[model samples]
Target: MELAQRVQSLTPSSTLAITAKAKALKAEGHDVIGLGAGEPDFNTPNHIIEAAKRSMDEGLTKYTPSGGIPALKSAIIDKMQKDQNLTYNQDQVIVTTGAKHALFTLFQVLLNKKDEVIVPAPYWVSYPEQIKLAEGNPIVVQTKEEQQFKLTPEQLEQSITERTKAVIINSPSNPTGMMYSKEELQAIGEICLKHDILIVSDEIYEKLIYTEEKHISIAQLSDSLFNQTIIINGVSKSHSMTGWRIGYALGQAKIIKAMTNLASHSTSNPTSISQYGALAAYNGSDQDIEEMRSAFSDRLEKLYSWIVDIPGIHCEKPKGAFYLFPNVKQAAALCGYDQVDDWVTALLDEEKVALVPGSGFGSPENVRLSYATSLDQLEEAANRIKHFIEKHKG
Candidate 1:
């Protein structure tokens, strides 16, 4: 059977593969401790669940506007004003199936064949694949761990070209969990503005920050940057609503309209019930977010110390998000593996602990472990990792 070239060229999700392998082992009666799943372990908040139930009881289950329900969009608009101090009318926002879907659709509308999107290394696993699917080239610019895995403005300026359509900025980044400060974002935003490149800011982890560092949208830096920027965010991370499938983009009305049209043909609208649930998420109390963020922070602090204490392991403390990315190249060498991926596989096989090899995130010398689980699980996983390294270290 023949498949489309675009589909054929797509890179399979390494995170999902690792997670599935862990699940398979657990099903076979191995005591697998998975540290690869990227979501919070918390259940959806009861109020949001009740809101969905109420919506269903009130017959809000029918088709909504392709972009989203008007009320939900209004909620989103209000959220932007209150949280980020950015103002947007309803026309500038489009809600989609998820932030991932929102990004995919944005690429489809924004990219022409052979055009390029600048992606920083250690990116979310889906970014490059989605760019490929849209017939765009993903130009990966590798960031150094010494610089906290952030793409510098100089690096951004060097990577841009006439074919460059946009650059992705995922603050409180996914695999690395590091954020760019406002000064850094200002510098990068200026570069993008000068080159007339779109600033695609993915703020999915904005509410999960553990440090005093605030998540600032590059779009909010100035009027010029705001006009050229597209903000992609959702309730998935912030509100423990990952399964609800509600994510959105805020940008100029023209791009938002094009994206809404694309979505009308594609997903038709985000789940109607889910939109109502997200409305509650945006308008309701933020107690749930505070609680979840606190849990992740506590886990991150404790687990990071344990991870850094491991022999031959080095990790930068993350400011936000729930993952710990540790440079384990020395550990891999000491354990007699040529690649960190192999070391990750051996750890899972021997110690029944699952971690995502950083090769998938464009950094082969590291590994990403989610502290989204309980402290007990993190402690146990750390002990197992320590033991594994000790047993194999030569």
Candidate 2:
């Protein structure tokens, strides 16, 4: 059997790959401590679960509009207005299977063969692969650990060429947990505007921020940029509804329409019951989200301290999200591994601690550890990782 060239060229998500390997080990009675998966360990809030139950009991388990149900769309609009101070009509929003789907849909609609997208180094594992699957070239811009792993305006400007179509900005980024300030976003927005390039702002972790720094929507900076920016958000990270598979994109009417059309031909609408659950999520009190964020922040701080104590490992204090991307080149060298990927594989095999290698995200000497688990699990994982390094040291 033969597959299409596009499908054959694509790579599977490394994050999920690591997770599956960890799960398989656990099934064989190994005590695997997985820090590779991105989703939180918490159960979905009770109110959201009740909303889904009510939808099922009311027989609302049917198909919705391809672009999403009107009620959910309206709720999303309201939430965006209140949270990001950005206004959008129902026509400008389209809910999909998840933020991943929303991003793929946007890329499918907007990208042409050979068009370019600028992705910062240590990006989410899916961004480059998704862009490649869309037949778009991914131009990577390297950002240093000293810079907090954030792309500067100059970096963004330098990466733009005649074939550039869009630039992806992931705040509270996947592997790094780095976020951009309003001023930083404004500067990059100006550069995109100068080149007439689109901004794909992935803000799925907007509600997961720590520190006193606030998340800023690039679309809210200016009317001009608003028309050129597509905001991707979901209930998975914020509401602990990963299994619900509810996410939405907000952008210009034409872009939204294109994405909706693509979705219509593909998955049609997201699950109707899940849409209702998402509606409840947006309309419900944000107090639940605040509590979760506070808990994650506490766990993240504890994990950060533990990681820095490990010899040959250096980590930055992330201001948002629940993951830490630590530069472990020294650790890999001490362990006599030539690559971070090899080190990660050995750690999972020898220590039963699962983590994603940075090579999958455009960096070859780092590793990403997600602190989405309980504080106790995080502490144990850190200790195991430390022991693994010390035991293998040259």
Candidate 3:
């Protein structure tokens, strides 16, 4: 069967593959410790769940505007004004199925054939593929762990070309869990403004920071920067509402309207009840979020300490998000594998532990492990990993 050339060329997400494999092993009665998922281990807050129930009772399960209901949009606007010091009218925001969908729609609306989007190395797995789906070329700028895996202004300036259309910035980054400071964001935002390139700020992990390092949206740096930036965020990560499929984008009304029109024809209207649930998440107390962040912080510290003790494994302490991306280049060689992916496969097979190799995240020397699980499970997983390394170390 002939498939679309675009679909044929797409790379499957390594995170999902390993997670599925882990599940398969677990189903076969193996005690698999899967660490490949990127979601919080917490359940949705009670208030949010109650909101969804209320929506259903009120017959709000029907279709809504493709861009989202006004109540949710208002809640999002309030959040941006309070949290980000950025204000936007309703016309400037469009709600989509998830932050991923918001980005996919934006890329479709913003890019032309062969247009380039500057993606930093160790990026979220979906960015490059989404750009490719939109027929845009991804210009990957590599960042080092020593520098906290952040793209420098000079690197951003170097990656831009006449065909460059936009740059995607993920604070509290997915694979690395490192965030850009306000000054760093300002510098990068300035370069994008100077180049007249759009900035796509993915702030889905905004509330997951674990250090003194705060999450700053590149769009919030300055008025000029805000004008040229599109902010993508949702309650998925912050409120543990990943399954609800409610995310949104905020930007210039023109771009947002185009994205909304695209959404209209495609995924016309995100789930109605989910939008209500997200509104509750935004308006309710952030206690649940803070609690989850605290748990993740503790797990990160313990996991980092354990990782450092493992021979041939090194990683900078991740300041945010729930994952630890450790450089295991030497570990792979010790395990007699040339590629980290093969080493990951061997570890999963031998130890029943799942990890997403960094090759898919554009860093072949490392692997990502999510700490979004119970502390006991994490400790056991750490022990298993250490034993695996000890057994394989040459």
Candidate 4:
């Protein structure tokens, strides 16, 4: 049997692969503790679920417009204006299956063969793969943990070439859980503007910030930048609606139209009931979000302190998102392991703990642990991780 070259060239999602391995072990009666899954353990909020139920009851189960239903599009536009202080018309917004789909559509519509995309190191696992699938080259800019794994303006400027078509900025970053400040964003935005480069801002974790720092969209900095930026966001992380598969993008009408056309040929439209659920998520009270954010913040603090106490394990306090990326190279060395991937695999095999190696995210010395589970599970996982490190160290 043979597969298409394009399909054969693609790599599977490492995060999902780790989760599947954990599930397979559990099915065989192993007591696996999985901290690799990205989605929150919390159920979708009641109002959002109720809206989906009502939509199904009202027989609104058919296909919607390719982009999205009119009501959901309007709701998304309003939410952007109110929450992010960015305004867009209905035609400028297109809801997709999720932020992942929005990003794929954006890349498919905008990228060409030999085009270059600036992807900061320690990036989300999907960014580089998605670029490759579009036949675009991924130009990686490395960042250090001491710098909180964020790309500086100088690094951004240095990476741009004549072939550079776009740069991806994932605030509340996927693996690092770090965010860029408004000033940082402005600096990078200026560089992109000067080079006439497009900005792909992934702000899916916009509402997940845990510090005094606010998440600022690069598009909001200037009108010119706004025209050049495509903002991708969704209800998956914010409203615990990952299964709902509803997300959106806001950008210039021309670009949005292109993405919608691409989506029309592919997914056609997002799920009808899920679109209604996302509409309610945007129009509904944000009180539920505030509560979830607070709980995650609390859990993050506890987890950070616990991991820091483990000798030779280094982790920066993440300001947003539900992940902690710790550099465990020293522990790996003590365990006679040569790579973080091997250490992670051994830990899962020996201690029934599952985590993602940093190698998958363009780093080779760290591991990503998601704290989206309950506090009790987090505590137990941390203890098991500590014991594993200590046992290996000795």
Candidate 5:
């Protein structure tokens, strides 16, 4: 069978590949410690579980509206108003299968052939692929580690062309966990506004912040920015409901309506049960959120300390998200490997610690490790990594 050309160029996700390898090792009875996962380790809160169960008991298993149930949309709008002080009508919101699907649907509806989306390097792995899948080009602009892996206004300005259609801003960013400040967003937003470029802001990890800095959306900076930005978010990370598969987009009514039409032909609608689960997630007490954040905060603190103390490894303490991205070039060099990817493989084989190499995230000198596991497991993973480096010391 002939494969489609679009998928032929698609690289399998290194994060998922490493995670599967780790699981295979464990099944073979190896004491593998996998840190490549992107989701929280916690179970869905009991209340949320009960809510979904109640809906099932009531036989709410039928299909919902293509976008989402009206009640869920209302709950999402209320959340935006309460949390971000932004108001949106149901017309501007379309609930999808997940935040990832929201992004995919958005690019499909927005981009034209040869259109360009300016993506910052050290980006989430799917951003470029999603853009490409939609027949758009991903213009990756490399961000400096010194700048906390953030794209500067100057960078954004220089990357623009007549073909430039949009730019992505993933705050409390995946892999790096660095966020753009309000001042930074103001400057970048100005450039996008000047060029009539759209903004795609992925704020999935907003609730897991460990810093005093509050999560600020680029849309919140101004009315113009709000009009220009499409916000993608979900309850996966915030409510520990990764399996529930509910996420949404908030933007122009016209675009959201297009997305809704597209979704109707694709999945018909998000699973009815998961929509109810997500509706409950949003409407219930945020005490579940607070408790989960506290646990992640402790894990981040302990794991960050242990990771940085190891020789030849340098990492910036991330303010949000559950992953630590450390530059392992020096460590790889010290371990006698010429490539970071090889170093990662050797660590897994020899020390039984699985990590996601940063090559997949467009930053080859680094590797990402999730601290979403138990403290004891994280501590052991750290110890194993330290031992791997020590044993291979040049």
Candidate 6:
């Protein structure tokens, strides 16, 4: 049997593969400590969960508008206004299965065959694959770790071409957890306006910042940029609602309408319960959000110190998100391995500590270790990692 060419071009998710191997090791009675999580270890807030239950109890379990229920759309609108001072109508938003699904849907509606989308390297693993699945070309520009793994205005200017349609900017980035500052965004936005390219601003990790610096959307830099940018975000990262599967896109009504039309035939509507839960998430108190963010901050500080203390291992402290991306190439070299991925494999085998290799995220020298676990687990994982490096070092 022949697979579709698009499916053939798709790369399997390394995150899931590592997770499966870790699970298998655990089942075999090994004390495996997996650090590949992409979701919060916390449960969804009680209020949000209660709201979902009340909605079902009131018989609101039926399908909703393909874009989203109006109340939920209004809640999302209020969130943007309160958080980013950006406003949008119900028609300008479409709730999808998840933020990942929202991104996948946006690419489907926005791209033509061979249309190019600029992706910064060390990107979220899904970005390139989703672009290719939509028959669009992903133009990945490698970013420097010294620059906090951020894309520069100079790099963005050089990467644009006639075929360029859009570029993705994931702030409070996934693997690296670095964010773009307001001035940096303004510079990047100007280049986009100059080149007449679309800005795909992904702010799903907006509420998880660990630093004094705030998250800035490229859209809010100016009116023109706001119009030129499409914002993709969701309750997943912010509200500890990963399993709820509610994410959305905000932009021009025309683009939202087209995406809605495509979604109507596809997912029809995001799960009705998830939308209600998200509505409560936006409408309720933010105490839970702050508590979760604080926990991540503590983990970031402690785990980072432990990771960098290992021989030949170096890491830059991330400002947001729950992952620490450490440069392990020198460690791998010291261990007599040519590839960091192989070093990752050896670590899992020898220490029963699982981590996602950086090769999958478009950087071959680093590895992503998620700290979205208890402090005890994080400390134990750090010890095992330090032990592995010490034992294998030349």
Cα RMSDs of all predictions? 0.7, 1.0, 0.9, 1.0, 0.7, 0.7
Poorest lDDT segment (10 consecutive residues) of candidate 5: 3-12
**CA lDDT, every model vs. true structure:** 0.93, 0.92, 0.92, 0.92, 0.95, 0.93
Model 2 residue pairs with clashes:
none
Q: Which stretches of candidate 2 lie over 4 Å from their true place?
A: none
Better of 4 and 5 by lDDT: 5
Residue runs of model 6 more than 4 Å from their true location after superposition: none
Consecutive 10-residue window with the lowest summed lDDT within model 1: 211-220
What is candidate 1's lDDT per residue for 170-276, written digit by digit as tens?
99999999999889999998888789999899999999999887888888889999899999999999998889989999999999999999999988889999999
TM-score (C-alpha) between model 2 and the true structure:
0.98
TM-scores for all predictions: 0.99, 0.98, 0.99, 0.98, 0.99, 0.99
At residue 22, candidate 5 shows an lDDT of: 96
Question: Candidate 4's residue-wise lDDT over 214-256, tens digit each?
Answer: 8899988999998999999999999999998998999989999
Local accuracy of candidate 5 as per-residue lDDT tens digits, 1-394: 9999889879899999999999999999999999998999999998888888999999999989999999999999999999999999999999999999999999999999999999999999999999999999999999878999999999999999999999999999999989889999999999999999999999999998998999999999999999999999999999998988999999999999999999999989998889889989989999989999999999999999999999999998898989999999999999999999999999999999999999999999999999889999999999999999999985
RMSD of 2: 1.0
lDDT of 3 by residue, 232-338 (tens): 99989999999999899999999999999999999979999999999999999989999998988899999889888888898988888899999999988887889
Q: Which runs of model 5 end up more than 4 angstroms from their true locations?
A: none
Clashing residue pairs, candidate 5? none
Encode model 2's per-residue lDDT on 156-210: one tens digit a residue: 8788899999999999898889989889999999999999999999999999998
Candidate 3: regions farther than 4 A off = none
